[model samples]
Target: MDKTTTAAPSAAALAAGRRAGWLRELRETFTLAWPLVIAQVAQNALITTDVIMMGWLGPKQLAAGTLASTFIMPFLVGAVGLISAIAPLVAQARGARNIRAVRRIVRQGFWATIILSALLIPLILQVKPIFLFLGQNPETTMLAEQYIQIGVAMFIPGLAVVVLRSMLSAFNTTRIILVLTLAAVVVNAIGDYLLMFGVFGLPRLELRGAAIATVVTNLFMFVVFLAYVLNHKRFRRFHILWNFWKPDWHHLAQIFRIGTPIGMTVLAEVGLFTAAALLMGLIGTNEIAAHAIAMQSASMAFMVPLGLGVACTVRVGYAYGRGDDEGVRKAGWTALGLSTAFMTVSCITFILGAPLIVTIFLDPDRAANTDALRLGASYLVVAGLFQLVDGAQVVAAHALRGLSDTKVPMLVAIVSYWFIGLPIAYVMGFTFNLQGVGIWLGLAAGLAFAAIVLVIRFAMRERLGLLRRTL
Candidate 1:
């Protein structure tokens, strides 16, 4: 009887097979996540360096820079979300071994980037009137306008880098991304110093100088990454740029269809934070400066989970393309677990080291910094409180993206952040007089809500019919 058909594998054997599968998946996820994590941290380092230098220029300039950033980030991050559609799309094509599809998706990603940049640049350039209308301090608004005028030039190249980086991430060629970003950090620092200080005979442009440096760094990154993608032997075979001027309206529309919700989702969340910043602006210059420092600290820690979330999208997209339900489950859960664990560590660190972290951005010895430093430390503790939920929400949202499930998540974000989060922030900070900390508490509440809902949706993917492929 063919040796009894080798007997159905014992329960123990099946258990061992599962254990091995989990271990293999964990390894793969870690490999993919580490480079992305480092790259993200390095990218943030570029921003942090600017913040530190801004602080050196004094609290007033720091506040101005923060105001400018709050305005710029919503548009920039939302556009990055749009360009990031290339990742899941390319990963799925790769999973199906469809080379032409990969090229088309990437080419269209570039198209989306260019189009978005054109629309956004004009809007961002009008920040002066917008901020003035919003009742921002006239002085800070003027300074912010000065900074943004030059910085907005980075918009196109910055979005282009997102498209290229998304393509590279899907292909698991992230080490080069890491190296390039790290180099940019150094380049940006040097540029910031020379131009901001007028060192080495360079003219001092101050805040405008910082903006120029950032634009140069972004342009450098885009040019180098594009060249690498076009010439690298591994990627050249796809001929992503071969058509140059041809349009793929189908894939272009597909990118917008999938990406618009993602951009809106990011905008909703970033908008909430921007609203909070505006609230802080209403409070005082010290509050705004403190909020900026605390936000930068939280954003720095957030990079790890964000990187893991991105990796999850690629892994889950690949599994979904192969129609391997179990693979998708493993990839998603493993990434969730890893992100949660890292965030737990970050939470503890923030709670215990808030003072130290605050001091990094503002000098405790400087009496001028006293109020901002104290407020920053307190805000950081609240940031710690929300860290876990923030990590969980990001990973869950990204996992859903792997399944091409974004529209519902966009609604979730709008409801959670705008409907639930912002009102609480306003009422608590102003009506209840809890001040800045209350605003932060509201942010925590929103993230916790998003975390719970999105995780539940992902957990019930099969039941909710979210795993069905629309593409």
Candidate 2:
């Protein structure tokens, strides 16, 4: 054979192999992200399911459901952050081929979650009355109390499920979370249909029924998650605390050592949105209602970026474990680029279809809506600008966490949400009289600042061997 002619086949083969590898990576990323994405969507659907079921019992039930849900957010998100300490830890352990450490991490997470859940129930119970005193109507206050009692009463089962789900995600078994989420959604929806409306021999319980459905579904899922995690190859070695697994003060210290700042990080950022929603309530139910509509739309766009953020943490943690500087850089860039591209398209769609999006939450007679149609449209329009920055900030924060440099980004959030975001929203909305859109615009500024600083910090950490130093 002629030398050049013979070499041509090898070149072609190499190119084909490269293409295949790229395709495989893309596939793996999609597969891993798909479960998380669906889980998030269904989780949102579960909330919407409550709202939809309550819509039948008149405005009071709907209003009560939304109001009570706000008090539940701190525990949910903060606990998720605390559980998230397992992901990077598991990823690094997986990369190092240390299955035992990963198992220990997950089991410890579950045991610790139980203690935290116990602590949280009373905090919410005591403060429930305080929220009621924050100038609510008589009817709304009564409904809010009922919803809170049912929901918080069910917090333990719900809390166990999330912590276990996080453990599954840590070992790259997101499929279990997706399955559980789907099961939970379907069961909850049916329970809402039956119990809320008194179908299928169930009594007409309405909002309380929705809460009970959630609790029952969560309980069912906790069992399923337990079964799957035990069967998982990565987790099979560790016993599931058949004996006493009391709170290891030292391990709890370690968890909170890593987890507390991250928990505060979640609390600060989500707290901003929750507080903004409450402030919107001050302006009018119209404003609060419109804000909810816009938020649902934004959350859809958020899923892609959110999935990217998860992937970033996994890749960053793995690269950091291997001590591969170049791999770490490539992983971060790839995650950011992919996330930004997908999210930018989603944002554009949201901007263009804001009204159509809002209409889902309304009817022609508009029974579910209390606001003008134009309000949600206006909110989504301004909200579009923030998607890019929001995507940037979240992905950056995830990457930083992957590198185990979580504190700086947490600090960035503190400044962005409190110092810059909330103050600006208050000034722009009430002070300047712009209201809902003004508040979102204020949030956009916070996201922009968070995005810029986190990206800068990521670069600094990568160059300075911050991951190496931390590990």
TM-scores of all predicted structures: 0.98, 0.90
Candidate 2 lDDT over residue span 149-248, tens digit each: 7777666667667667666665668877887788888998988888888887778877777878888887888888888767767665666554436444
lDDT score at residue 62, model 1, on the 0-100 scale: 96
Lowest-lDDT window of 10 residues in candidate 2?
A: 242-251
> What ranges in model 2 sit over 4 Å off?
1-28, 55-59, 242-250, 367-372, 469-471
Question: Candidate 1, residues 270-359: lDDT per residue as tens digits?
Answer: 999999999999999999999999999999999999999999999999998878899999999999999999999999999999999999
lDDT of 2 at 290: 68
lDDT of the candidates, in the order given: 0.93, 0.75
Clashes of 1: 0
- Which runs in model 1 stand beyond 4 Å of their true positions? 1-9
